[model samples]
Target chain A: EDQVTQSPEALRLQEGESSSLNCSYTVSGLRGLFWYRQDPGKGPEFLFTLYSAGEEKEKERLKATLTKKESFLHITAPKPEDSATYLCAVRRWDGSEKLVFGKGTKLTVNP
Target chain B: DVKVTQSSRYLVKRTGEKVFLECVQDMDHENMFWYRQDPGLGLRLIYFSYDVKMKEKGDIPEGYSVSREKKERFSLILESASTNQTSMYLCASIPRGLNEKLFFGSGTQLSVL
Candidate 1:
């Protein structure tokens, strides 16, 4: 079975603190890994997509890195506005477009 | 920018009543999805359509059905609303390809009484 698990269900970080959220997956054939940020009562916003190990993508203060077994979302000097639930999902290479998603990590960056 | 729009931001319906949730995308994408979000459960796929008149059931599709009569629009229907079915419904779209990012709408919060 294909499964995605995100650790540290909730994290409280002070403003300007840097941290990394983990997304671990077990699938047959890896196609792509995705990261998204969702605010309260809103749909998720796209962050990055990593297709292979050793790949990394960055946007503003967010950086996402991928590996064979896991992916990491690193937040650099996070601000209060950056607080949101980070979601991770994976697509398998079995010719299916369905994405299996994790439970997500609720991040609160306190000022 | 890719735009996926859900028709309602909030809805209130009574138990045993039928409900409809509408979603539309303007990027000419061939794939559209419906998901429900709840606390500690993240987002679970309910149904998806790859083309007009083609629908597939997702992880949780027991009490739900979908329609895709047109290329740009998808609708999720609840045959009989229940208290346990109250959730935040999300709609997303992606172009027909691999490794494409999904674009999502603002979402609709459905409350069942």
Candidate 2:
């Protein structure tokens, strides 16, 4: 069975706090991994895509790195505006078209 | 920027009433999807369409039906709305390729009473 797991269901950090959120997966074959940021009551916005191990992508204050079995979303000196639920989704290379998703990690940065 | 538009941001419906949710994408993407989200649970796919008049059932399709008569539009229908059906409905679109990023709409908050 293909599954995606995201750790730390919720996190609270003060402004300027740095942290990393984890996403691990078990699948037949890894096609790609996606990261999204979703604000309350709104649709998720695309963040990054990691296709292979040793690969990384960055935008603004967030950086995403990928490994063979997991991925990490690192936040640097986060601000209140960076607060949102971060979602992880994976695509299977074994002929499956749908993307499997993790429950997501709720992040709150207090100013 | 790729844009997926959901017709409603909020909706209120009575139990047993039929409901229709509409979504349209501006990008000429071949794939469109409908998903419902809730707290503690991530996005759950309800239905998807690959081409005109082509549809597929997703993970959670019970009590729901979909229509795709055009390439850019997809619709989700609830034959009989129920309280348990209340949720945030999201619409997304992607090109035919598997690695492409999904573009999403603002989503809809549906309340069934």
- For candidate 1, the docking band is medium
Write the residue-wise lDDT of candidate 1 on B3-84 in tens digits. 9999999999999999999999998988899999999998999999988999989999999999999999999999999999
Deviation from native of the Cα of residue B66 in model 2, angstroms: 0.3
| RMSD (CA, angstroms), candidate 1 | 0.9
Estimate, for each residue in A12-93, the C-alpha lDDT of model 2 and write its tens digit: 9999999999999998889999999999989999999998999999999999999999999999999999999999999988
DockQ of prediction 2: 0.67
Per-model TM against the reference:
0.98, 0.97
Model 1 lDDT on a 0 to 1 scale: 0.94
- Lowest lDDT sum, 10 consecutive residues, model 2 chain B, at B93-102
With candidate 1 superimposed using the best TM-score fit, by how many Å does residue A16's alpha carbon deviate from the native?
1.5
> B3 in model 2: Cα distance from truth in Å?
1.4
